[model samples]
Target: AERYKAANQRAVQLLEKCGTTQVEVDASGLLTYPIEKVDAGDQPDKKLKPLSVDEERFMRAFYEANVQEVCSAFEFPHKILATALQYFKRFYLQWLTCVYAACKIEENHVSAEEIGKGIKQDHHVILKYEMAVLQA
Candidate 1:
């Protein structure tokens, strides 16, 4: 519940900065953010709506199903899939914290693609560090 509140706050911050949460996809599959002048005094708390119980449940189910689909699509071994899923769960647990911290430090609205790329980069760094530790 606390994490959900933090995540909601982070999303509100992003929406307030970007004007809308929806991103435009171009013909080349590139995302373009819409720019609107939001009043500095605009209250995010009032503008952002919290997810209802049913919506939250649906989202959770959808995410789990998608994760399973991705694992199956790649024909990943059960052990490998389990490890990946664990990492994803752990990542999500910290996602709101990381995003909130990043927003404070950067003072910019981070896009979903940017967050995805950052996670992928972090995975690569972890793998490299693990390889180094194994070699030592």
Candidate 2:
């Protein structure tokens, strides 16, 4: 319908105004945050863990793909998918838990215990190795 087309066009304009477009690396091989506004996570004394620049980049890139894959399998929206990816990144920012924790939170209604049980991986070992993986 014409109305639907008009509304969709308006939505695209609004998204451009709000800078909700996809983040992309530039042609020069530089990672760029294209959004108009960035809220820095700059709270001193928050006891927040630090991630190295490389680690942060890797985490974002890796989780972005992982989130997309999981969302496709689970039929989730970008919002939920993005939230899970953020949670995974934040959890890694502090202490390392099992990759299962990230997958659980991102995928919904699953737990590290359940994943470990189903996959036959030691939950304890996975948790233990988490920090080292992040460090490496």
Q: Each candidate's lDDT (Cα)?
A: 0.46, 0.49
lDDT of 1 by residue, 36-64 (tens): 55543576554655465457657766655
Candidate of highest lDDT: 2
Error of 2 at 56 (Å): 3.9
**Model 1, C-alpha of 15: deviation from truth (Å):** 12
lDDT of 2 by residue, 1-136 (tens): 5664565567556544443433433324344666544222333343223344555567677756755665555465566666656655555431223243445445555554654565465555445444433343
RMSD in Å for model 2 = 16.4
Error of 2 at 12 (Å): 43
The 10-residue segment with the lowest total lDDT in model 1: 127-136
What lDDT does candidate 1 reach at residue 116? 40
lDDT of 2 at 25: 37
**Pairs in clash, predicted candidate 1:** none
Stretches of candidate 2 off by over 4 Å are 1-52, 93-136
Q: Give candidate 2's error at residue 23 in angstroms.
A: 33
